[model samples]
Target: MDLQKPAVEPQQPEGCLVVAIRMPVRIVVLVLVVPVRMVWDGLVVVGRFLGDAVLRPLGRALLWLGRVLLVWPLVGLWRYVVVPVGWVLGRLGWVLVVVPVVFLHRYLLAPAGRALVWLARGVGAGLAWAYARVLTPVGHAVLWLVRYLVVVPACWVYEWILAPVGRALAWGARGVGRLLGLLVSGVGVAVYWITRVLLVLPALALWRWVLVPVGRVLAVVAREVGDALGHAWRIAGHLSRAVGRFLATLFRWIFVEPVRWVYRTVLAPLAHVVRDVVLRPAAEAARAVGRTARQALAAARETVRQTRADVRRALFGEPRERDAVPRREPRPLGARTLDSSTTALTKLTKD
Candidate 1:
C-alpha cells in the first residue's frame, strides 16, 4: 500500500479540464499559486505608482533642463561675440574722441601756455633789469662807504695800534719773566749757602753741647705756658661771645626799638599827612599839567600838520607821502667837520 501511493498533479483554478487531483496536492498548488499571483500584483501596482510619483516629475525636470541648455548657447554667443564687439566699438569711439582732444591740447593749448609763460618771463626780466639799473649804483655806493669809511678804519685801529700794543706788552712780560727768573736763582743760591754754612754747622754744634738740657727746661716752660694760654683762650672766647650777645641785646633795645617807636609815633603820621595833603595834591597838579601839555602838544601837532600840508603844496606841488624827498639843511662852518672827518677816516682806512 505504501508503494502504490503516488504523487498527484495539482488542479488549475478555472481551466476547463477534467483531472483527478489529490487533496494535499491541490492544497499545495493553491498555496503556491496564491502567493505567486499576490507577488505579481504587488509588483504591477508598485511599478504604476513609481511611474506616477517619480518618473513623471523626473521627465518634466529633464525637459525643463533641456530647454535651459538650449537657451544657454544663444546667451553665450551673445555675450562672447556680440557684447565684446559692442564694447570694443564703444572703446574705439572714446579713443577717437580722446585722440582729437589730446592733439588739440598738445598743438594748440600747450603753445598758448608756453607763449604766455614766455611773455611773463620777458616782463619779469625787464622789470628786474630796470630795478638793477636803478638800484645797483646806490647799493654800491652805500657798500663802498660802509666798507672804506667805517669798517676799514675800525679794523685798521684794531690791527695796527692794538696789535703793536699787545706785542709790546708780551715782550715786556718776557723781559720781566727773565729778570724774575734770575732773581729767583740768585736768592735760591744765597739761601742754600746760608743754610749750609751758618744754619747747619751752628745748629749741629749747639745740638751736641747744650740742646738736651735746654730742651728739657724749655719743654717744662712750654707746657706751663700752653696750659695758661689754652685757659686764657677759652676765657677770651666766652667773654667775647658774651660781649657780642650783650651788644646785640643792647642794640635791639636802644636803636631798633626807639627807631620803630619814633617811626610809629611821629614820622608815620607826618608821612601820611604829607602823602594825603602835599604829595597827592602835587601828583594831581602834575597830572593836570601833563594833560594840559598833552592837549597843547596835540594842538601844536595839528597845526604843524596843517603847516606841513601847506608847505608841501607850495614846495613839492603834492601832498606829503612816504616816497617824498627828505629836506636838507644848509651847513654852517662847524658842519664841515663831518666832511673833514670822513676824509680823514677814508685816508686812514686806505692806509
Candidate 2:
C-alpha cells in the first residue's frame, strides 16, 4: 500500500487565502478601532458626570423657573381671568342667542309647522275623498273601456298570431347556437395545443434543465460569500474588543491609579483635618449655645411656677392639704370606654 495519498479528502472550514486575509485585516481593524473606543469611553464618562452632577440640577432649576415664570402666571390667568370671562360669555350666549332661538322654536316655528301640517292633512283628506268617491268609479270605467278597445285585441293577437311565429324563431336560434358552440370548441382545442407546444414546453424545459441548476450554483456561491463575511466580522469584533480591553487597562494604570492614590494620600487627610478642626468645633459650639438657652428657659419656667404659688398664697390665704389620687379606676362589668390619651402616658382627669 502506498501511504502517500490519504483515503479521504480533507475538508477545511475556509481556504488558506481567507486565513491569510483575515489575520492582517483583524490586526488592522483592531488598530483602527482602539482610538474610537477610547474616545467613546471618555465621552461616556464625561456625559455621565455632566448628567449626574450638572445637567440634572440645572434641569431641575430650569423646570422650577419655567413653572414660576410661565406656568404659574398662565394658570392664574386661566383661573382668575379666563374662567370668569368664559362664564360671562356663556351666560350672555344663553341669554341672547339660545333663549331667542328657543323662544322662536317654541312660540313661532312650532305653531307654524303644526298649522302647515294640519293644512296638508286637510288637502290630503280632500284628495282621499276624491279618490274614494269620484276617481275610483271613473278609473273602473276607464279600465273597462281600455280593455275592450286596446287590451283584449292585443292579448288575442299575442296568443294566436304572434306566439307560433316566435316559437319557430326560437327553434332556429337553438340550432344556430349549437353550431356556433361546436365551432368555438374546436377552435379552442386547436389553440390550446398550439400554445402548449410553442410556449409552455420550452419554458418548462428551460426552467427544469437550465435555470434551476444555474440558480442552485449561484445560491451556493452567495451563501459561502455571506458566511465568509460574517465570520470575518465576528473575528474582527473579537480582536477589537481585546484591543479595547488592553487600552482600558493601560489607561487605568496610567491615569486612574495615580489619581486614586493622590486622593487617598493627600486630599483625604485634608478633608479629615477640616472635619475634625473646623466642623466638629462649630457643631460643639452650637450645641453649647443650645444648652445655655434650654437652661435659661427651665429657670424661667421655675420662676413662673413659684410666682404663681406666691400669688395664690397671698390671695387665697395659705395652701390646703394635698389629696392623694388613685392611679387606676374600676369599670362596670362588660362595659368599656375609649379615651383620647393613654393613662400610662398622660395624667387622667379626676371626676
Candidate 3:
C-alpha cells in the first residue's frame, strides 16, 4: 500500500461562500439595473430636451404675444391719450386757479411782506443806534462812577494797608527760614564728617582693595567668556546663513521657478485661450443681443412717432407750408361792380 495522503481542497469562509452563491443573483440585478437606469436617464434627457427646445420657447412666445396684444395697447392708451388729455386739462386748471393766486401774491402779499421786513429792519437799526449812542454812554458813566466810589477805595486800602503788612510777614518768614537753614547745614556737615571718618573711609578702602580687584578679575573672565561666546555666535550665524541660503536656493528651484514657469508658459496661455475661445464669443453674443434689442426698440420708436404724426394730422388738418405766400380769393361779379362804382365816385369827388 502507498503511504500517500489523499488530496484535500481548501475550505472557503461562510461569507465568501454566500457571496459566491449570490453572484448569479448579483449579475442579474446588475443587468436589470443598468438597462433600467439607462431607460430612466433617457427619459430624463428627452424630457429636458423637450422642455428646453419646445416648452420654454412656447411659453416665451405666449408671454410676448400677450404683452403685445393686451399690455402694449393699455400702456399706449395710458401714455399717449390719457396722459396728454390729462396734462392739457391740468394746464388749463392751473392757468385758471394758480395764475390769480400768483398775481395776488406778487402784487399784494409780496409787497406787504417786503414792507414788513423793511419796517422790522428799520426798527431794529433804530434800537441798535439808540443803544449804541445813548445807553452805552450811560452804562459807561455808571461803571465809571461805581469804580471811583467803591472799587478805587478798596484798591487803595489793599495797596496801602494790607500789602505792607503782607510784605513784612514775608520778610520775617524769609529771615527765620535762612537761620534754620544755616543751622541745618552746620549739623549736616558735622554728621557727614563723622560718617566719613568712621564708615565711609573703611567702605572706600574695602572697595578700593578687595572689590576693585575682584571686579577686575570678574571683568577679565567675563571678557574672555564673552569673546568665546561671540566666536561661537559668529560660527553659528555663518552656518545658519549658509543653511538659509541653501534653503532659499532649493525652494526657488523646487517651487518658485517651476511655479513662475508654469504661470508664464501654461497658465498664461490657457487664460488667453479661454478668453479668446469662450469669453470673446460670449461677449460677442451679448453684444449681438444688445444690438438686436436696440434695433427693435428703434423700430418701435419710429413706428410710434409715425403713428403720432398720423393722429396729429387727422385731428388738426394738414399744416400749411411756412414759406408759401397767401393768395387772395377771386371777387364775385356784383362785388367787383360795386368796387368799380366806388372807385369812380372817389375819382369824381377828387375832381
Candidate 4:
C-alpha cells in the first residue's frame, strides 16, 4: 500500500522554465552583468586615450598652420593622398592604389563627362546648323514654291480666262461680218435685177415699140405744161403783189404807227435814263466783276501751274515736250485705187 501510495502521489511544478529559475546557473548568469560593464568601460577608455594621444596633436597643428597661411601644404597632401587612399580602400584596395583610381577616372569618369559634353555640343551645333542651312532654306523654298505654284499660277489663270471672252468676241465679229456680207450680196442682187427689169429692159422695149409716139406725146405734153406754167406764173405774181400790199397795210396799222409814236415820246427819254442810271453802272459792275473773275482765274491758273511745276520737279527731272505736231504727206488719188482698177478706168476713158 505504501508503494501504491508512492505511485499515486501529487507532484510539485516540473516545467523547464520553472526548474531553471530556481537553479544555480541562473544565479551565476545574474552575477555576470557587472564584470561585463566594467570590461566594456575599460575598452572604451582605452580607445579614447589612444585616439586623443595620436589625433589631437595633429589636428591642433593643422589648425595652427591653417590660421597662419592660406595655402596649407599638409591639407593638399592629405587630399591628394588620403582621399584617394580611402576611395581605393572602399573599392577593395589592391596592390596598386593610385594607378587603378587614375585609370578608372581617366578611362571611365572623365571620358564619360567629356562624351556627355561633346554630345550636348554636337546636338546644339547641329540644331543651329539645321536652322540656318536646311530649315531656313526649306522654309524659303516652300514660300517660293507657294508663290510661284499657287499665287502666280492663279494670276496667270485669271489672265488666261479673258481669252474666252476674246474668242467669243472674235466669233461674234466673224458672224456679224458673214451676216453683213450675205445682206450686202442679197441687196446687190435685188438692186441689179430691179435695174435690169425696170430701167434697162423697159427702156429698150420703149425704144423698139413706142419711142416715136411717146416722143410726140411728150412734146405735146411739154407744150401744154409750158402754157399751164405760164398762166400759173402770172397768177402767182398777182397773188404775191396782193399779199405784199396786205402785209404792208398790216405793218402800218399794227407796228409802224405805234413804233413811231413810242420812238418819239418814250424811247428818247428812256435811252437817256438808261445811259445815265442803268447802263453806265451795269457796264462798270460788269467790268469790275470781269476783272475780279479774271484775277481769280489768273491766280488759280498760277497756283495750278505752280502745283504742276512742283509735281513735275518731284516726279521727273525735266519738263515734258510740248506741242509735238506730226507732219503728214498728202496721198495721191492714183494710190487710192487698185492698179487694175486704175488701168481699167484709164482704158475706158481712152476708148
Candidate 5:
C-alpha cells in the first residue's frame, strides 16, 4: 500500500512573499535612513545659513535706505535741474523741427533727387548717343537703300528672269525621267526573252529529270533520324544527373539536419537567456535614472547662477570697476611755465 503524499512547493508571489519578508525590514530601514538624511540635510544647511547670514544684510540695508531716500533726490532733479531745462527746450525744439528739414534737404529734397537723376541720366545718355551717332548711321543708310534699291532689283529679277525658267523646268523633268526609264527597260527585256523561250524550257527539263533523285532520298532519311535522336538525348542526360544527387542527399538528411539541430540546441540558448536574464537589469536601471536626472539639472543651473549673483550684489552696490586710464585734471603751474616758455621760444626761432 503506497501512501506518501507531500510534494507541494511552487506558490511564491504574494509580492514575492512580501519581498522575502521585508528583507530584514529593508536592512533596518536602510540603517535609519542615513541619520534621517543627515538631519534633513543639516536642516537645509541651517535654513540656507539663516537666509545668507540674517536675510542678506537685512536686504542690503533696505536697498540702501531705498537708494538713499528715493533714488538720489530723483537722480539730482534729473541730472541737475531737469537737464539744463531740457537742453533749452531741445534747442527750441530743434529750431522748430530741424530748420524745415534743413530747408527741405537744401532747397527741395536735394534738387528733386538731382533733377530726376539728371533727367534720367540725360535721357539715357541721349538715347545711347542717338543709337550710337545718329541712329546707327541712319540704320546703315536705310539698310543701304533697301540693299541697293529693292534687294538689287529683286536679285536681278531672280538671276536674269527666274534662274533660266527654273533651269528649263529642271531640264524638262530630267528628260521626262530618262524617257520613261528607256521605255520601261525596253518592255522588260522583251517580256524576259519571251518567257525564257516559251515557259522556262519545259520547267527546266522537269526539274533536271524529276526532283533531283527525290531529294537525295529525303536527305538520307533525315540523317538516320537525327542519329537516333542524338543517342536518346544522351541517355536521358545521365538519368537526370543521377536523380539530382539522390534528391540532394535526401534533402540534406531529411530537412537540413533537424533545422541545424534545433538552431544549435534550442533557439541559441533561449537568446542568450533573454539577453542575460532580461536586458541587463533593464540597462542598469536606465543608467541609474539618467544619472539622477543629470545631477538634478546641474544643481538647478548652479542654483540659478547663485541667485542671480546674489540679486546683482544686493541691488547694485559693488559694481564700479572701470578705470583703464582717464584721470587728467592737473595743468596750471602757470601752464607748465607757459609750456616751457613756448618750447624755449620755438627752439629760439629754429636756431
Candidate 6:
C-alpha cells in the first residue's frame, strides 16, 4: 500500500554514523526497556486473569440484578399500569372534548363556512358581470382612440425617416469594429510568443534539468532512514522478548519450583491429617449433640401439651352438641325447566 516501499524490501545502504550508532543505541534502549516490558507483561497477565475469573461474571451478575431490580419493574409499570391508564384517559378525552368539538364543527361551523362561500361566489359573479358590461367596452374605446391619436403617427415616422439613418450607422460601425479586431488579434499573438520565449521555457528547463534529480536523491535518503529505524525497532523487540523469556525461566527455577515442592511434600499431608483425624471427629460429636438436644426438646413439648390438656379437662368438663337442622331444597321432585301444559296437547292413543 505504501508506494515508496517495494514488494520485497532490499537492504539499505548504511552510512558510517549509522553503523557506529546502531549497536550502542540498541544496547542502551534494551537496558532501559527490559524492566518496563517485563512489568507490562506481568500486568497484562494479571489483568486478563482477573477479567476472566472475577470481573466478567461480576459484571454479568450486576447487569442481571439491575434488570431484575430496576428495568423489569419499570417495564412492568409502563406496560400494565401506565398503558391502561393512558388508554382510559384517551377514551375519556375523546368523549369529553373531541366529541363536542366534532359536533360543533359539523353542526355550527360547517353551515357558517358554506354560507360564507356562497356569499363570496355571489360577489365574484357580480364583479365579473360588471367588468364585462362596463370596463371591457370602455377599455376598447380608449385603446382605439390612442392608436389613431399617438401610436399610428409614431409608427409612420419610425418607418419612413429613422429606418434609413439606423441602417447607415450600423454599416459604418461594422467596418470600424472589423479593422480594430484585426489589429488587436495581431498584437495578442506577438505578446503570447514573446512571454513564452522569455518566461515559460526557462522555468520549464530549470525544473526538468535542475530540481528533479536533487529531489529524487533526497527522497531516496529519507526512505532509507525510515526503513533503518523500522528495522532497528523490530530487532530490539526480538531482543527484549528473548530477555523476558530468560527472566521468566529464571524466576520459575529460583522461586516457583521450590514453593511448589514445599506445598506438595509438606503442607498437603498435614492438611489431610487434620481433616481425617481431628476436625472430622469433632464435627461428628457436634452433630450428635445437636440431635440429642432436639429429641429432648421435642419430648418436653409433648409432655407440656399433655399436661395442658389434662388441666383444661379438669376445669371445663365437656362441650355440648349442636341441635340438628332440616335441609331446604329449592324445587319439588317433579319440577323441570319446561313444565307440563306449557306445550300443545297431542292425541291420547297415537301409535
For model 5, residues 1-351, the per-residue Cα lDDT tens digits are 112334678965544534444455445444544454445545776799999999999999999999999999889999999999999999998999898899999999899999999999999998999899999999999999999999999999999999999999999999999999999999999999999988898788777887776675555445434533443334334444455577779999899998999989998999899889889888998999999999999999999999999999999868889879976988656655543646868668667
Stretches of candidate 2 exceeding 4 Å from the true structure: 1-77, 226-237, 271-351
What is the lDDT, from 0 to 100, of the residue 93 in candidate 5?
84
Model 1, stretches more than 4 Å misplaced?
A: 1-218, 300-351
Report lDDT (CA) for all predictions.
0.77, 0.83, 0.81, 0.75, 0.77, 0.82
Q: Which parts of model 5 have CA positions greater than 4 angstroms off?
A: 1-22, 32-34, 41-53, 64-66, 77-82, 104-109, 112-118, 128-351
**Best-to-worst ranking by lDDT:** 2, 6, 3, 5, 1, 4
lDDT of 3: 0.81
Q: Which pairs clash in model 5? A: none
lDDT of 4 by residue, 40-135 (tens): 545765789878997788888988888667557667767998889897786775546767888999899998999999999999999998899889
Q: Can you write out model 6's per-residue Cα lDDT over 1-351, one digit (the tens) per residue? A: 122334686767867755665666556655665565556656777899999999999999999999999999999999999999999999999999999999999999999999999999999999999999999999999999999999999999999999999999999999999999999999999999999999999999998998997786666556655655555455545665677699889999999999999999999998999999999999999999999999999999999999998998889966678898877876666654343443444223221
By summed lDDT, the worst window of 10 consecutive residues in model 6 runs over 342-351
Root-mean-square deviation of each candidate, in angstroms? 70.0, 13.8, 31.4, 75.8, 40.0, 9.5
The digit string of per-residue lDDT tens for model 2 on 65-178 reads: 999999999999999999999999999999999999999999999999999999999999999999999999999999999999999999999999899999999999999999
Q: Judging by TM-score, tell me the better candidate of 4 and 5.
A: 5
Candidate 6 CA-lDDT value: 0.82
Worst 10-residue lDDT window, candidate 3:
227-236
Instruction: Give lDDT tens digits, candidate 1, residues 60-155.
Output: 999889868876777888989999999999899879988888999999999999999999999999989987997788899999999999999999
TM-score of 4: 0.17
Candidate 5: deviation at residue 163, Å?
40
* 3 against 5, candidate with superior TM-score: 3
Model 1 / residue 21 / CA error / Å: 99
230, model 5: CA deviation in Å?
93
Where is model 1 poorest over a 10-residue stretch in terms of lDDT? 14-23
